[model samples]
Target: MALLDTSRTAPGKGVAPLRSAAKAALEASGLPGRKTEAWRFTSVRDLTTADATPAQGGLVVDAAPGVDVHRLQGELPADVAGWLAAVEPTLPNAHFVALNGVLADELVVLHAQGHVVAPVTVTHHGAGEGSVSTPRLLVVLEPNAELTLVERFGGSSKGLTNAVTQVRLGANAGLRHIRVHDVAQASLIGALGVAQERDSRYRSLVVSLGGRLARLDLRVRLEGAGSRCDLDGLYHVDGQDHVDHHLRVEHHAPHATSTQTYRGVLDGRGVAVFDGQAQVTRTGPGAEAHQQNRNLLLSEGARAHTKPHLEIDHDEVVASHGATVGSLDEDALFYLRARGVPREDARTILVHAFLRELLESAPTPLRDELAAALRERLPRGEVTAAMELALDVDEAKGDGIEGDA
Candidate 1:
C-alpha cells in the first residue's frame, strides 16, 4: 500500500515550510476512504484524480460598508495563518487543507469592525476545461461587531473547485452568512470552519443547486458561554447529479446553543446525503442542540441517505436529532388532485411547500430570492405541464371555489 496517499499528495508550490506543514498534516491523518463513517455515501475519487488546476475569471468583490478587506498580495498575514492553523489542524479533511495550500490563489482577509446592514458579496466563478481552483478566505469579527457575508459560486460543470473558509468571532460578535451555489455544471469540494467566543452568534444559510458532484463540510466550535450557532440549508438535484452535506458542532463551554436543519428535493437519478453531529462535552452544561433532515425523492431512481448523531456528556444538556427520506404525501396529493389540480402542478406545489416550511424563517429578501431560484430549478416533466394548465384553469374560473382541500 502506498504510504503517501491522496491526503499527502501536495502539489509542489507555495513556500517550502508551508508545503511541509501541509504534507505532515495529511500524512498524519491520511485521506478518508469508503469505510469512514462520515464520508460513507460521498466519494472523493474524482477530486483526488483531477489534475487540480488553478481557476481564473471568478467574481470581483470589493470591501463593503463597515467591513475591511485585505487583499493579500504576497505573504500570508500572521493572524490569518494562525486562524487557519487552528481550524484545518482539527478538520477531518485536513488533507484537502494541505492540498489547498498549494493550489489556492485568491487570498483575502475580511474583518468586520462595526454593524453593517449591507452584505459583502464574493463571487467565485471558474473557467477552462476541468480546471481546479482553491479560494481561501479568512474572516474575523471584533467584539460587539456584526456583518453579513455572502458567497456565490459559478463556473463549468466539469470543473472541480476546492475552497476553504476560516472564521473567528470575538465576544458578542454576530455574523449572517449566505452561500449560493447556482452553477449547474461545477463539481465543488468545499469546507467552512468557525470558532466562536463568549456571547457571539453565527448563522449560516446554504443553497446548493448545481454540480455534477457537490460536497461541503461545515464545522462550528462553540468555545464560549452564551454563544449560539444556527445552520439552515436547501438543496435540489436531478439527472445524474449528486450533493452531500456534512455538519458538526462541538460545544466546549456552558450555555451554548446550536440548531441544524436541512431539506432536499431529488429527482431523476440524483442523489443527496446528509450527515450531522452535535457533541456536548462535560464542560458544556446547559447546552441545547437540535438537528433535523428531511428529503423528498420524486423519481424511483432518486436517492437520499441521512444520518444524525448527538453525543452528550453533561446531565444539564438537551439534544435531539432525526432524519427522514420519502416521497410526496399521497394524502395531500390526493386532496390537490380532487381540487382539479394537475398531477404535475400538484407535485411541484408539494416540493415547494416542503422547502417553504424551512425558508419561511429566512430573511424576507433572501427568502424571496431563494424561492424564485428553487422554482426555476424544479424539474419540468409531464406534471409540470399539467401545473401550467391548472394555473390557466384557475385564471379562467374567476369564481374562487378553491378548496383548502
Candidate 2:
C-alpha cells in the first residue's frame, strides 16, 4: 500500500493542508511487504496506525528537562527565515499533522551563517488530554557552514506524537543532530524524513527511553560527491512498550560514505526492532557504506529483531552489514558474582557494558545527559552492577592499568 492511501482519512477539525500532505506521504510510503528484504524481520502494520489526531494547544507541562527551547530561537540565523518562507510552499501539507501530542504553537528554523559552536535545543511537552501532537521544523545549512541541533521530547500526556523535520544541507556544510525521546509510557510516536547535500556531513544520534509504542524513520540521500553521513540510535524498552528504528541511506553520488549503528535493550514482554538498509547505485563508484544493529533481551519474554542490509551496484565500493540478538552472558555473570559483586549489581554491570559502545561514540555533553537519564529510568538494583563495572572500566583506563600485564 502507498503512504498516501494510509494517511487519507479525514483529519480532526481545523486540519491544515500541510497536515493532510503529511498523511498522504505516510500513506504513499506505507509499510514494506513480506517481499521487501529490508522489512522482513519487523512488520509495518503495527506502525502505520491512523488513530492519531491533532493535539489541542493547551496541555500543561510540569517541567521541561534537558531542553532549552530559547536556545533554538537564539540560534536561528536571518537567512533561515527566508529559506523557510521559500520551502514552506513546496512542502506537502501532510508534514504538519500531529499524531499524539499537541503541536507547538510556533515553528523554529535555524539557518547556518558560518560555524555554530553552541548547540540549539527544542523541547516538546504534553499535558491535558492524551492526544497526538505534530511538531514541524525546517533547517538549512549554507555551504561550508556548521551547526548542532538537539531535540528533546518529554511529557506526562498519554497519547501519540508524530513529528516531521525537513532539512537541507548545502554543499560542504556539516550538521550534528541529536534527539532524545522520553515520553510517558502511554504515548506513541512516529518521526519521518531528513535529506542531505553533496560533500555535506549529517551525523545523528537518537535515544528513546519512554513510550508505549515508538517508530522512527530516517531517509537520507547523499546528493553530492564526497558527502558523508552517520546515523546512531539507542533505545531501552521495558514493560509492554515497543520501539522500532528504520533507516535508509541512499548514495546518489560517487565517493560518498555512510555509516549506521542502532542498539536496543528490551525487558519484560517488550519488543524492539531495527531495520537498516544502505543502497549504493552504479553512479556511486568508490562509495563506502557500513551498517550494524545489536540488541539485548534482558528477560525470558523479551524479544528483539534486527536486520541490516546493503545493496552495492558499484564493484569498487566497500560495504558490510551485521546484526546480533542475545541475552546476558551467564559465564560473565558468574565471574562477577564469584568476585564478590552482588548478583543484582553484576547483572546491572553487564547490561551497562553491553550498551556502552553506543554511548562512548555519542557527543560528550549528550553522552553525559543520556547517562543521567538512563540512571533514573533503569531499575535501581537491577542496574547497579553495570554501573559499578562501568566505573571500574573508567578508572582502569584513567589509571593506565593493563588487564593482561
Candidate 3:
C-alpha cells in the first residue's frame, strides 16, 4: 500500500526521524481500509493517497468565543508538565502540520492546585492560500483534580486541518472534555486518543458544525473499576460537506460503565455517518454499555448512515446498541402549517429543536455559548421563521379555553 511505502512517500525534510516513526506507527496500527469493519463507513485512502508529508502553513494564537483558557495558562502539576515535555518532541511529525490551523507549539499548559471549575478554550485560525495545519495537545489531570477543557477549530481559508490530541487522566482524576469543530467551508480531519487510570472519569462532548470534510476518531479505555465514561456528539452539515464520526469504548476492568449518544442533521447534498462500537472483554464481567445514534435529513438529496455495534465477550455484561436515520416528521410539519406557520419556518423550528436536545445536555455556560454560535450560522430567513413560529406556538398553547365555552 502507498501508506506503507514510508521511505519514498514521506514528505519534507528536517523531520525525517518523526516521519519515520509515524510510518512505523501507521504500519503497526494497520491501514484504515474498506475491509476493516471499523472503517467501513469512512475511507482513509485520502490520507495515504500520496506519500505522507509535513503540511506547510502559519500558526496563530487568538481568542474564540465560547472557549475559555485561563486554567491552561496557570501553574501545572509536575507529572503533567513532565508528560507535556515528553510529548512535545513528537509534535513536528503530526499529520495536522499540513493544514493552516493551530500548531502544537502554541499549546499553553497550566497546573491545577486542587479541583478546578474554570474551563480552557483553544482556538485555531487560518489565512492566505489554503494549507494543511495540525494542532497537538497533551493534558494531564492530577490526582483528585477536576477541570473542563474545550478545544475549538475554525479557519478562514480553503484547506485541510488534521489534528491529534492525547490526554492522560491521573488516578482518581475527573475531566470534562468539550470539543467544537467549527471549521470554515474548509476541511478538517481530527483523531483523538485518550488513556484513563483507576477511578477516573473522562467525559467528552463533540460538536461538528463546519468543515467541507470532517472526521473524528475517539478511542477511550477504562483501565480501572468504577471508572465511568460519557460520550456525546452533535453534528450539522449543509452544502456539499461530509461528516463522519467513529467511536470505540473499551472496558478493560470489571464494573466499568459507559454511555454514548450521537445526533446529526444533514442538509443540501451533505452526507453524515455515525459508527459506534462498545467492546467488553472477558475480564470485564460486570461491565455495562449502551449506545444510541439518531439523525435527521432536511432535503431529499441529503443522506445519513448510522451503525451501532457491540462486541461482548463477557456473558455477565449488559450491552445494547441501536441507530435511526430519517427525515423530518411529516405529520408534525403539517400540524405547524395548519396553524399558520410557514413551511420553511416549520422545518427550521423542528430541525433546531431536534439539535437543541444535544446542546441542552451540555454544561450551562457551554450550552449557552454554543446556542449563540449556532444561531449566527443559521440562514437568516430560517432563523427568523423559527423564532416567529415558536412565538406563535407559545401564544396558541397559552390561550387555553378562550373560545372553548
Candidate 4:
C-alpha cells in the first residue's frame, strides 16, 4: 500500500517542476507507522492532517540588522536532477520531507561567503486560528566563513507549522545555530538536514517548551574528514503537552567526531519522547561519537520515553549512547530538606540541578530568555526564587533577545 497518494495533486509553489518525482517519493516512503523502526514510538497524526494556513495570535518578530532575508522568488535550476542527487535520494522517503517539498511556501535563503558579525534571526509567528504555515530555510557557508543563525517560533494560536531547514558547510567553515520555541497547544513538525565538508564544524542548541504536539527531527552527516558536530537540546513540557525529538548523526568520513546531549523535564500529564541514533560507516575508521538522553518526570501522571542507538561498521572507532528516565533524585531532595528547606523548595532545587548544565551552557543572549520562559511555565513559585534563584535574573533585564519574540 502506498503511504501517500500524490496523484491528482499539483506541485506546490516552490517545487512545481518536480511534482511527479515528489509524489513518487511520498508514495515510496508513505507515512511511517508503528512498525517503522525510526517512528515506531511516536505518532505524527497532527502532521498527516496538517493545515498550511498562517497561524493566528502570534507576535511578529524582526530579523537582526543588515541581514538579507529574501524569498526563493525565482525558479529552480534547469538541471533539478543534479540538485536532488547532491543530497541522499532517501530524502523524499523520509517522514514529511517529500510532502514539504511539494507543499511548502517560498523558501528563505541565507547565504554568506565571509564571516558575519552578528547573528541572523528567523521568526515564525501565528497569523490566525487553525491556519498552517510551512517555512523553509537554506543556509550556505562558504569555506573558511563563519556565522550564527537563530530560529524562534512562538504563538498561542491553534494551528500547525511544519518547517524544514537545509544547510551546507564548505571545508573549514563553521556555524552556530540556536533554535528556541515556546508554543501553546499547537501542532509543530520540524526537520533539519545538514552536510558538512572537510574540517568544518557545526554546533546547535535547541530549546522547546510546552506545546500541544511537537516533533523535531535532525539529520547531520559528517561527510568530510576531520569534520565535527555538536548537538544539545532542552525540552520542558507539562499539562498534557506532547513533544518528541528524533535525531540521527552519520559519520561518513575518517577522523570525524559527533556528540549529542539532550535533557527533558516533563510534569503534569505531559509526555515526552527522545529517539537518537549515531552511525559510523566503514569509511570512518577514526570516528568518535557520543550521545546521551536524560529525562525527569515531576509527577505521577507525567511520562517519558527514551531510546539511544549506536551503530558502527568500522574497525577502529569509539561510540557510546545512553538514556535515563526517572523522577527527581530522592537522596538530593532529602539532603535539601534536611538543610531546613521546605519540601517544595527542595524539589525545585533538585529539578534545577538536573537542568542547570544545559541551561548554563546555552548561548549567552538566550540564557535569560530561556530562564524566563521556564519560570513562566512553572506554577508561580514551583521553584523558590524561580527566576532570581535558578537563573541569572539580574542580567536578563532587557526586553528580549535582540528583538526576538
Candidate 5:
C-alpha cells in the first residue's frame, strides 16, 4: 500500500480532528526524498515501496507507583491533544508522525508528579509480515518532579515500525530517558521531541542495536532560562543494516545549556549517518552548546557520514561542534597483539574501547546490557582473555582503567 494513502483508514475514537489534519499534512508533504535537506543522507525508499497494512501492536507498560498511565479512548489529555495538534503541521519531515495520526487507534500518556525512584518501562513487540505499527507516547512531568523512563522497540523482519514520543517538562522538573531499538530485521522510523521549561533538565541516552533500516529524529528545545539538555547516543550496525541519527538542539532562552555526544560502530556493509545542529538564538545570549560525533568503521565496505553544525545568532553564546569518522587505532591493536592477544581478539578489544566512553554515561544495568550487545556484533574471539590483557597494558602506562576493558 502507498504510505500516504489514507483512503483505507479512518480516524479512531477521540482523534478525528487530528487525523483529518494529519491526513491533509501528509498529502501536502508526501514522502521526503533525498533532495530534502533533512533526509539528505537517509533514504525512504523502503517506506515508499512497502506494502504493509496498518496494524495495532500491544504495549507493555511497567509504571512506577507515583506515575500515571492513561490510554486515550475518548478524548486525549488537554495538553497532549494540543501538542499533537501543534506539531503535526510544523515538525520537519513529519510524514511518519502524520501517518501515525491517520492510523493509530489510541495514544499512551505517562504523567509524573513527584520524585519517582523506580523507572517506567514501555516495550513494543514486532508486528507480522506486511504490517505497519505506529505507536504514540506522550510524557508529562510536573514542576519539581523527577522520573526515569525506558523504551524498547523490536519487530519482525518483514514488518515496519513507525513511532513518535513527545515530552513536556515543567519548570524545575527533570527526566532521564533511555531508549533501545533492537529490531533485527524490521525497519524503524522514530522521532523524539522534547520541550523544557525554566530550570528543567532532560538527559537522554539512545542505543540502537539492530534494524534493516533505522532512523531517529531527535529535537530538543530549551524554552526557559537555566533549562538544560544532554543527548548521548550509541549505535552498532552490520550486515547491510542502515542507521541514521538527526539531532537538533535549540537554545531559546538565556542561560540555557545543551550538549550532544554520539558514537557508532559499523562493520560489513553497514551504513551510518549523523547530522547534528546546535542553534543559539538571539534571545539565548548566555547559552552554552557543544556537540561531537565519532564513528568507527570496522570493515572496508562500511560507510559513515557525519556532520556537526552550529548556528549562533548572539555574540555572548558559547558553542562548538565537531565530528570524526575513522577506523580503529592501529597502535592500540598492535599493543594488544604484542601482549599475546590474537588478531581477532585484539580488534574486539579496540572496538569495545572506542564505544566505552559513551556507555559510561548509561545506567549500570543498561551499560552491561549494551556492552554485551556490542560484543555480540564484533568479530568473535577470546574477548574475556583479550580484555584482561588490554587492561594490563593500560595499567603498565599507569592509567586507571574504567568500563569493560
Candidate 6:
C-alpha cells in the first residue's frame, strides 16, 4: 500500500529497527481480503482503496494525578520498546498494527505507580480528509496499583483512524478501561492487547456509535492465577453504517475468569457484527468464562451477525456462550402501550433499557454523556427527569451484578 509514508523520521532509539521489522511484516502479510478467515465478515476495501495520505495530527492526553504520561520522542524505555518489539511478531492480523508501527507519529505511554483516583483521558484527533492516522498507546500498572483510563477517537469524518493499544497489569493491579468511538463518516480499525498478572483485574467498556466502517479486535490473556476480566460493549448504527467487534480472551492460568457481554442497535440499512471467543487452556483448571451477545434490529433493512464461541481444554473449567438477534420485545411494547404510553416512546424506552445494561459498565460521568448521545439518536429523542433519576439509581448499583458462569 502506497499509504505507508515513512517520511516522518523515526522518533526513538530502538524504534527505528522496530519500525523496519514492522514494515517487513506489513509487506509480507499485506491487507486482509474478504477470504481471510477472521476478516471474512468484514472488508478492508475502503481502507486499501482510499488513496489516503499519512495523517498529520497527534494525540492529546489529560494526565491524571499519580499517573505518568510520556510522549515518545527520543529514547524509548526498555520495557516499552521490548513490549512493542514482542507484539510485532505474534499478532494474528498484523497489517494494521504493522502499519501503526510504520507510520504512527508518536507513541503515548501511561504508567501508574500507585493508586490513581481520577481518570486519565487520551483523545485522538484525526487529520483532514484523504488521510490516515495511526495512533499507538501503551499502559502499564505497577503491582497493587489501580487506575481508570478513557480513550476517545473522533474527528475528520473523511479520514481513516487505525489505532493499536497494549496494556500490562502487574500482580494485584486493577485497571478499568473505557473506549469510545464517535468519529462520524470515518473508517476506524483498531486492536487492543492486554496481559494480566496474578490477582490482577481488568475491566473494559467499549462504546461504538458512528462510523462508515468501524472494527475492533480485542485480545486479553489472563496469565496469572486469580486474575479476572470483564468485557462489555454497546454499539449503535444507522444509515448504512457498518460496525464490527471481535474479541478473544484466553484463560491460561488456574482460577482465571472472564465474561463478555455485547449489545447492538441497528437501524435503516445499518449492519453490525459480533464475534467473541473464550478459551480455557489445559492449565486453567477452575476457570469460569461466559459470553453473551444480543442485537436489536430497528428496521427491515437492518441486519446483524452474531457468533459466540467457547473452547475448553480443561475438564474442570466452566464455560458457556450464546448470541441472539431479533427485534424489540413486542409483548413489552404492548404492555407499555396498554398503559397509555405512546408506541414510539415505548419503543424508545425499550431500546434504552436494552442498552442500559452495558452502559451501566461505563463510569457515571461518561454514562451520562453516552445516555444523552444515545437519546439523540433514538426515536422521539426525548428524556424525562424521572428517566435520568432512574439511570442514577442504576449507576448506584455499581459492579455488584454477577458476570460469570
Tens-place lDDT per residue, model 4, 1-405, is: 111223334234454534445567777776787787766666765545644443222322244543455455336554333333454432322647766565554656566667777877778763345565556666767789888888887767666666677777889989998888776866677788888999999998888887887778888988899999999998888887888888889888999999999998899999888988888878646899999999998889988889888988766988788889888888888888898988877776667656657878566567766766776666544464553543444335554445446
| lDDT of residue 399 for candidate 6 | 33
Task: Put down candidate 3 lDDT per residue, 142-170, tens digits, no spaces.
Answer: 67788777787776656556676666677
Off by over 4 Å in 2: 1-53, 56-107, 381-405
**Taking the tens digit of each residue's C-alpha lDDT, what string does model 1 give over 263-333?**
99998898998989898887646899999999998889989999988988767878889999988999999
lDDT (tens digit, per residue) of candidate 5 on 341-389:
7887777777787776777867767776777777777777248445545
lDDT of 5 at 112: 96
In terms of lDDT, model 4 sits at: 0.72
Error of 1 at 135 (Å): 0.5
Question: Which order, best to worst by lDDT?
Answer: 6, 5, 1, 4, 3, 2
Residue pairs clashing in model 1 are 157-185, 344-383
The TM-score between candidate 3 and the true structure equals 0.76
TM-score between model 4 and native: 0.85
Native RMSD of candidate 3 (Å): 6.6
The clash numbers for all candidates, in the given order, read 2, 30, 12, 8, 1, 0
Candidate 2 residue-wise lDDT at 38: 47
